[model samples]
Target: MNNIDTRNPELEGLAKCPTGIRGLDEITDGGLPAGRPTLVVGGPGCGKTMLAVEFLVRGATVYDEPGVFVAFEETAGDLAKNVASLGFDLNGLIAQKKMVIDHVHIDPAEIEETGEYDLEGLFIRLGHAIDSIGAKRVALDTIEVLFSGFMDHAVLRAELRRLFSWLKEKEVTAIITGEAGETTFSRYGLEEYVADCVIALDNRVVNQIATRRLRIVKYRGSAHGMDEYPFLIDADGFSVIPVTTLGLDHEVSSERVSSGIKDLDAMLGGGYYRGSSILVSGIAGTGKTSMAASFVNAACARNERCLYFAFEESEGQMIRNMRSIGIDLGPWIESGLLQIHASRPTVHGLEMHLAMMHKLVSEFQPDVVVVDPISNLISVGNGLQVRSMLTRLIDFLKSNQITALFNDLTQGGGAMQSTEVRVSSLMDTWLLLGYVEENCERNRVLSLLKSRGMAHSNQMRELILSDDGIHLTEVYAGTGGVLTGLNRLTGEAKTNAAEMRQTQDLDAGARAVRRRREALKATIAALRAEYESELDELDASIARERAQQIALEDDCSMDER
Candidate 1:
């Protein structure tokens, strides 16, 4: 054989068909093996049929490849009606000759044991369906139903092999669904027949919460993701979340976004970095939500879209509460710059919550997202589960270059520095909000625990909330400890009083020194006046002596002149 490049089969006549479903093609390395039979095994209600149908629908609508869907369990009408909620117009596609759905209804009670059983009839029917629409894709929903009437494993295996062979000969990409078994991938162990690619879907419930997951079991000629991915099925249809996207290869931005609190921003070295995950953790009533709201407000003020996920409060309650702190989010909401999604943590499983968040983020395309109180997510999952969910979430947000702020409620009487979810390392900036007890009073304080790639203040600032907004005040650290609230106010008051007394004493002493200087000046002026009078008398005595001697000193006066 000529030198073949087995590593890259796509370039060597092994092309892959794109699924067009969001995130599915990425994990599959470009969807299923083209013109090959791929097995999809899943339990009941685990979305095996849905995945198969979406594959055909996307192929037909997006790739312009007509497809045929052969249903073994449900009728064409039922399948169409079931998928109608997902906006897949099966009837419309059938009318337009883009798709053909042939429901092969099989009743085990009506079947008779035959000497030799085969899928020759199925081949004729499927071949006609494909030729009718020139279909390039085919989906057999629940292959187990077709073979339920046959008890001979030899006949079943032979027929399955023949079926896959026929599809390959026709050069049509196909997906075969089978009921998942307890010990095998399928009840009949169909994984042996369809060896090109295999996918397993599961619907697992833990602690009364349900989550759908998808895993690529094997791909013969391709390098695909091996990790199990969480997928969501809603009105929008299938969305496979690829865990591979959580890698550390995501791009970073040097831009920064404000936190709305000026002093807090100053302490954070101007603001939080754009595309960074920020964690605002604190105890109850310690203004965690307030800080989150302030960040949202700042984002909205910058005319950037913001999404707020509130787990504890309703939208109205959050709006009202934020308005009290001078951060009115109503305008942003009305102006379409903000969206608040409020729900309880018990509403959905951690994976479901993550899926919903992914959906909303994709739809809204917000520049900034805030999740108030991620601690509540712990109610639905354990610590490890919550951390995994958060890690994926943070990774997703960072990959999109979206600034995400998460508020965590740290339990009181525990380590105040740690978070309940235990994902602090995932955050690029961590702001801890807490309260200090001083003088029998509780005062809120905000501290910067960590800020990556910048210089940040380490001092704890008192968190002050007023009608104007949230403010951070410099806290006093004395010999006793950090003084806050009433204690700091009292200390400042005493210091001011002492300074006032000292200033008054200094003013009084300066006044006494001025009075003494004035008395000395008066004494010196009296002494100078007396000296001038004595000098005048001495000049007069000199003049009289000169006049008495004038006659005898006439010649001397002339000489002196």
Candidate 2:
């Protein structure tokens, strides 16, 4: 582990620029180079522009490093307004002479490309902007915009090399954003080879799920995170979550927390370990929320702070419905043991949601956290982002020893079967709940799919909600099978009971037969012993008679013997 000092040398004696984005600096080993050109290449809507703009905004506000942005796409005013939502005061920074934004509009129709044209004019303009603010950071959005008026590949390629060399000579850390092609990263084709560092951004949709990924293609003289990390784009800007290492260093706790349901807690190996994450996955209306609410209430009942982020249901509705199920969240909220944050998945970017979650986790420092239906969050992000966000969230909770419960909604179809199979592999513990149809009745059923580092009962149980709260019945084996719906489970339970009674009757009959056989054996043994005793007495009498006759004879026979 190479620990590079990130403190600012100019102010407090350090030489690093913290991007102000979480999880990104850790991957870069510190941050981008202090005074070198780094290329940001990605397809359209890959957040290339937003990332560059954020770098400048953070530099100006956080580090006091004055910066400049040369925009070849949006207007200066538009750029400022677009990022205003993120709490970036671009106009104020520019007014204070701490930052400068130059919108360069090139018209290909007006210019004639008759001969080789040099980019000296572009250089002069950028130099003037840099000198005006004494900027340490510069961003040239879409450097390929210069190629709009010219078709000559040789001239454009030569000028591209010159532009990179000039930025290095100027000693300013520059970010040159370019439009990436489907086959190659950038349309210019030269940005990849010329820049000191090449970063690629990609936006993809898998199974109707959209996600954004970032990969550091190359970083000269430094080893960086080579994997494609998932990132979110929201009102606060872009945030990347670096994948965590799975090592023995992960902290384990001996403490335990209740599952809210007494029986369920007993089912677990003496309740879930503190800070362990449990996954509750099921089809819709399988009592996922009810189970999660019970857990939250249980935690709060113990005076432990808990956070519930609801992505599917409204807070008011959730609270009201939970009350019907015998969970009183009102008192917990009043006592400040429980907090519920409800929002729409599409309201903001996934990164913003993660930031909010991070913010909440930091502020509340809860002992327990619940994400009501994590699958809904996956709907908003791409598969990679979904996986990435989940991995980070799980690791964060585990590290803090905060027990987390996630509710995942599985679709009820063949297509959903594949998705569930994929998701099941990521969970530490999986609780499957669903509706089963048996005897022309639909009933709720719950079962444990798997639990890591522990032994769990392999039984399909009936789930019942009553005044006593949630209840789980013993393993039910129906005529059809053991893993059936609630009615079938109940039927199976009855069938098992009947079979058990029949088994007991058969055992009693077998015991009676064994008792009869033992009595006959004792009677025969007694007869044999009596007969042998009589025979011995008779033999003695015969000897005595012979002795009397023979005592006269046996006495005579004893005399003769």
Candidate 3:
């Protein structure tokens, strides 16, 4: 046998086939190895058959490459009905000659183990199905019945190995499913070692909740995410959510969107970036929803589409609740500028929720997406899972240049930290909301916890909700803390009173100085008048003296004559 070069295809330029599964194609680097058999082993109800059926179905539907599915355990009709709920008309595809489904029923009791029995019959059936449609893809779902039907294990293993190699020789990409063994991944321990790629599916219950996951156990020539990823089986089909994207290569936007509250937007450095993720975390009854409503209104006012993922309340209830605060989301909803999707967080697993968001985002193509009370997702998933989902969400939104706003409902009365601690670090901006008590009354407080790229105010503003909408009041900090509510009014009163008194004193002192200046001016004017009169008299006396001297000179001249 020639030594084969088995390296990651991503680096070796080996071709790959796209699975067309939502995130599965991305996770597997590009999908399974092209024209090679991939072994899918998992426990019952783990979606082995579904995965195989989807592989062939997508190959024919999306790739335009015809496929054949050979069922060893299920009949063609049963297989068709099973995936019909997923909207896959396997029978219709068969009628169109785009796909072929062959059922190979093998009975162990009817077969005699005296002769040399290879998988010639199985090969003939698979070949006929493939040749019927000129298929480039084939699926042998759950190959464990072959072992139960065949008595010789050695002959079965040899035939299985030959079967995989022969499919590769025919250049048809095939999928082989098997029951999971306790120690080995497959029952016969023969498929995994022979196939070019191996994938494991799992459906486990944790904390009374079921989570379906998929993982790539082995790949002959491709680099893939080996971590167990969350997958969802919804009406659309199987969708895998990769934990997160590779790097921060997503595009950033310089455009800013208003936060709805004018003063609050001013504090956020002219609002959030277009493609950034925002976390509005706060304790209950602290205007978190009001803030989110303001953002939605602003987005709709811009004529940009916005999606509101409401987890706490229904659409009508949320509209009514927001109306109480003077935010008329009803008009926007009617106008179709805003879409509010209200679903209970407990309705599905976290992965399913993520998948829903992804689907809506893709369909709506909204400029902004709002997930109200993201903290509620924690009840279904652990911290790591939530973080992973958030990371992926943020990456997707950023990549699409779509703004995502997440509202986190804190647990305790002022437990802002516990709500979005894991997601806070991933968010582009974190707005913390809390309550301040003064004069035996509660007041809503808003403060910026962090902002990644822009300069934001560090001061906490008093969040005032009224019929006019949310208003952010300038907060004054005294020795106690940020003065709010009645305290703020009292502080403003005292400050105004002090300023008035100081102005009054300054005015009184100015009057006194003006009086003194007028008196001094009068005295200087009188003194100048007196000095002028005295100088005039002295000049007259000098003139008279000169006259007398002239007269004496004239007398002397007459005597001389």
Candidate 4:
């Protein structure tokens, strides 16, 4: 979007001059209107000066477009000293003839009301400065100061129009800064109507935390983002976060990424999808951070870059704590495969934290990102704000094809599946962790609440954290409901004992039946033998009685034969 040749053809009619600042060009669809005057209005200390100066500096340094800074509020030396912290060397640019800074000092005490006041002398000075460096960009710091004591509305409006027309005729893109008015965008209310584009800057404090935002109030002849984007001004200069730029149209990957625990991956049907947003929600002491660290460790083990955002604990503290679970993040940090950014959630507003996350992810180019305990963000913003911020963050990470794992803390005494920030709907996969109390013992349990595009297990498993690592064991479920902790062990033991006793009883019954069958067979054998002996004895007695008859029978048998 920043590239001139690659910008959409529809936006080609309105030529845009790239601001060269990170994320600014994206929201503008290209950048500010080219060869036109843009009014930047803001309250005091709202970064109007910094924004104007950085615009000029970026033009001169990055785009190779020489720019002139006509300052009405500060001298050239003061301007240089003020912006030096942002790494902009005004003296170097001036020495190289790439920039020109001219201070137009206006003293109200010396000013006298003259008939038909016009900025004729100011034009000559500005024109000379523009021509001296062949500047293509010009910035007027606080143009309202030029006519400080003027009370004629007609004169102020006419001169403002004339000045804007002159800049247009010169064909140099100009930025005119103005103080925010009580009821209007600018003090004179007419600057916004006259300029080609108007940008508003706001510095608001919520819960004692300051957050800066930028909004494009109007952009004539161009379609631009109207949302108030969070911007950061630090040592790296201005960076606007285009949170809404990414939508749900990002391409998805079928590839899988491990959840770091072997059985947990099995429950998730091979693991979470690549480029997916996973939410690990649990009550306190349910190993949310440990889960996040495990994912980070797994990612780092693949030689992939990982970024861990720790809001509750410092980097060293997290590293040391994770070591207890056999997850030593120190080596990954030392190898440059992992970066741990630790800061209290209250240190900045939710949007600022979102902006910093965007910035770090862009710079680090990590394959996986882990935000430990995203619930801490609730301290800075309401539930809706946190949800919005997380939605944007998830979209941003998905758009970049970075797998993100967020640790969310679920409040106790609430629905086990519900998270305090209510961002569960934004996650592609949600793993709910909590304590399952049974038989006078509390045991950590994990269950797959939901996983998009995969068959996930709904059964709860006992989550065990040992010295070696995390382990997931199947909990015992029976007529007594789901059993965990010592109850599960006891149930298993009882089942085993019952099975063993049943086996022993069956063995004894089979032995007794075999013994009875053996005895019966022996008795039958004895009875048959006794009958044979009786028959033999009867035959012998018959033989004795029939001995005489046998002789007679033998004679008869011989006669019959």
Candidate 5:
């Protein structure tokens, strides 16, 4: 969107000059109104000058459009020196004939207010600078100096009107900076209406904390963001972070990614979907960082690059800690598959951090991104800003199809809830990690709170961390409640004893039945043996009687034969 091409038909009627500042082009739908004057009103030290300078510098560098900077309060050398740290080589650009810096000092004490006094000299100088470089952009840094130099309002107003009209006639997009006044957009209260666009910059100390913000007051013939956006002036330049885009229209991925823990993946129904937001909420010492590190390790193991944002712990500290748990992230870091970026939550404002995330993500183009303990951001801003920043971050990651894992630290010992970030609804999977105190010991338990578009497990498992890695175990439940530690062991022992007794009784009963069958068989065998012996004896006795009878009837048998 920042690539506002002059040949682009969509931007023909509404010619937009791309600011090249991060996130500002999206807020403006392209950039400031092209070939028209825009009034930038802000108090002292509110980055108005910086914004204007960056616009011109970026125009010359990125857009290949020449620009001229007309400074009335500061010298050309000072202007160049001030923006040198931003990596803008004004001198180099000037040498290349891409940019022109013309400083016109307007000191009220040195100027003489005479009749028929006009800014013809100033106009001729500005016009000469523009014509010399064929510039398409111009910046008049703090035009309020004109009001200070001229006493008569009518003369200044008429000249200002003519100058603005002349700028439009020149067909060059212009930025006119003005000093903000009490109850007025500008000190003159005229530039705001004279320009086609008006933008307000504010830098205020709220509760002793400084914050810089920007707002688009008006833009003729265009739709622009009206809400106050937090902007940052860092080494890169002015970066406006607009409000998070609201909608669920982002494309989703059917691909699944491991949560690093095998049991956790099973609980999540085969792991989190790609381009999904995962929330790991737990109290201090509940292993939130460990979970996040495990996920990073898993992503790296798959040869996928991961961006790890460490809010509390330093990168080395996190690596060492994970190594203690037998999860070696050293290999991933060495292989360039994992990038651990550590920063204190209070190091910068929330929007600045958000912008930095965007900068890093765009550069790294990682497949997975992890923010360890996002709840620490609550210390930097209110709930709304935190939520907005995270929402935008999630949106950005989703747009890039990057899997996001957020480790959240919350207050311990309460009803299960989302982190202080309060973005549970935006998460695709929410895992609740808390402690279950039993037998004077605290045992960590993990459960799947929410998993969209998939069937997830609802059972709470004992989360055991050892040198081997994460392990999920079934906890013994009894009359009181779920049991763990020695209580769980005692319960298992009693269960084992009962099972052993039942098995012994079954074995004893089988032995008794076998003994009774053996006794009955032996008795039957003895009775049959006795009957056979009796039959043998009775046959022998009959044979003896028959022999006696045969002896007596021998003579009769011979006669009968």
Candidate 6:
């Protein structure tokens, strides 16, 4: 049989392997160095094997790069079955002669090292498998197993050097996975000096919260990210997300899109900019999803295609439930104006979710995208990973000029407080919804927390969902308080009671004033009559005096006349 040419001169200038993992390639500046051995050193259960397997599988499926998997720990069958849940058909690939899986079972109890033991047998087997299928990628999972089975450390080290030289000679991009020790990184104690690239994976638990971290310790002759990045492992596989290093060169758009609610649109100074990301954060049952759905419906009504990614609820269930709130997604779906992609947060890795979303966005070419309750996704990964994932997602949407809406569920008495602390700075517009207890009953209130590059109403508006659809009524500002929910009605009643008391006080004062005025008028009339009677009596007395004195006054009167 003609020996396959394993030597590749292009390996010196080879591009990084894309890995086909969303957000990960961006962090690694494309992918791991091509045609070179990279050491993946990690503790137990840190996803070393999973990452290697995924790399090989992605190469096989996505990039059409045939690969070989050499497992020193588990049998080839077990590896295949374990990853079957992730939708990888390793056995089929092997059967099709496109891939090779070599199980290297080396039991320490069976080893009788009378002389120098060389890994020449293992190398021969690897060459046979690779030559069989012309494989371009190879993975040796947990090389530490071979070292642990042998007590001859010097021989193992010498053999490891030869193995690396042989792999370089083979010219296939190789990944060597080794178990991490308690203090040192690799169990073999050879990772630091032999590998062209070193990658470390760590899993840590603090306060009942488990977090996975990945770091590129060293990469020879190439610039690489040095910071520890966050990652997640789910149904699909491992995904690494590096935090964004924001640059001023990001694309910007001045185009605007309509808010689903007319009044809310008016409040937003026209509407949100096209491609701008809006965050709707609120407590449980605060209608965040309803608001997002209303916007999606509005977009659909405008004949603009939209995608809704529901993490907490199934598409069918969401459709059925939202119908009661006046949002009928079924018609939109049937008309192809709306598409709902619903999946659990843990159903797949964050990278897988992002890749699926990227694919959907490309295929649908939607004008709007909605992620209902992004906080549920936050639960699947660490803080750094979640933040990085969101940043990349937002950047992708912004670059594409796709209007994106994200919902975040808030917890505790100050539900949105944590969200504000964590994610508010990343959002272009922040909408807050919550329960307000003003009266004896509770009510729902919606408010615009902030809107960048646009003026927005600071007042809290009451959101009402009737048969007509979602409605935002005028903000109620009265003596009691602003209208929230049932409490607003109670506040209105209290305000009315206070106003009635004031009215009754004014009526009592008017009655007292009328009584005093009537008493004064009667007294004046009586005084006037008494004065007239006295005047008449005085006139009669004067007349009688005049008559008696007439005889005497005749002569005086004649004289006076």
**Number of the top-ranking candidate, with lDDT as the measure:** 1
Model 5 CA lDDT for position 351: 64
CA lDDT, every model vs. true structure: 0.89, 0.80, 0.86, 0.88, 0.87, 0.81
Clashing pairs in 4: none
Query: Model 5 — which ten-residue stretch has the worst lDDT?
Result: 2-11
Return whichever of 3 and 4 wins on TM-score: 3
Candidate 1: tens digits of C-alpha lDDT, residues 1-561: 344655455466778999888778989888888999999999999999899999999998999999999998899999999999998999999999999999998888998886876778888999999999899999999878866766776877888899998899999999999999899998889999999999999998878887788999999978899988878887778988775554587798888789999998888878999999999999899998889889999999999999999999999999999999998999999999999999999998887798789889999999999998899998887887778778888988998999999999998999988899898999999999899986679999988999999899999999999997899999877655778998888777877898999999999999999999999999999999999999999999999889878866887878898
Better of 1 and 3 by TM-score: 3
- How close to the true structure is residue 475 of candidate 5, measured as C-alpha lDDT? 76
Model 2: per-residue Cα lDDT over 65-107, one tens digit each: 8898999988999999988887788899999999999999888
Full-model lDDT, candidate 5: 0.87
Which pairs clash (backbone N, Cα, C closer than 3 Å) in model 3? 9-221
Per-residue lDDT for 1-561 in model 4, tens only?
467666666566688999888778888888888889899999998898888888889999999999999999999999999999989999999999999999989897877776776767888999999999999999999888866756676777777788889998998998899999999889878564455899999998777777788999988887888899877787778877776774479999999998788989999889889999999999999998988888888888989999999888899898899899898989999999999999989888886788789879989999999998899998997786677778888988998999999998878999887888888888999999999876678899998889999998889999999887799999999767789999998888999999999999999999999999999999999999999999999999988887888788889989988
Ten residues in sequence with the least summed lDDT for candidate 6 = 1-10
Residue by residue across 419-500, what tens digits does model 3's lDDT show?
5436788888989888888799899888898998999998988889998899988887865567999988898888899899
User: How well is each residue in 58-108 modelled by candidate 5, as lDDT tens digits?
Assistant: 999999999999988789899899999888999999999999999888777
Q: Which residues of candidate 6, in runs, are more than 4 Å off?
A: 1-23, 57-66, 77-98, 128-136, 205-211, 233-238, 245-255, 283-287, 303-372, 375-386, 392-402, 409-421, 434-446, 453-467, 473-561
Using lDDT as the measure, what is the rank order of every candidate, best first? 1, 4, 5, 3, 6, 2
Off by over 4 Å in 4: 1-12, 113-116, 149-153, 192-195, 248-255, 300-306, 315-320, 323-339, 355-367, 395-401, 527-561
Q: Which of the predicted structures, 5 or 6, would earn the higher TM-score when compared with the native?
A: 5
TM-score of each: 0.86, 0.70, 0.88, 0.86, 0.85, 0.68
| Candidates sorted on TM-score, descending | 3, 4, 1, 5, 2, 6
| lDDT score for residue 531 of model 6 | 100
Model number with the top TM-score: 3
Which runs of model 1 end up more than 4 angstroms from their true locations? 1-13, 247-256, 273-275, 298-305, 330-338, 359-367, 395-402, 453-455, 478-481, 501-561
Q: If both were scored by lDDT, which would come out higher, candidate 1 or candidate 4?
A: 1
lDDT of 6 by residue, 90-196 (tens): 99888877788899998889988898567788888999999999988899997778777889878778888888778878878888998886677787675754557
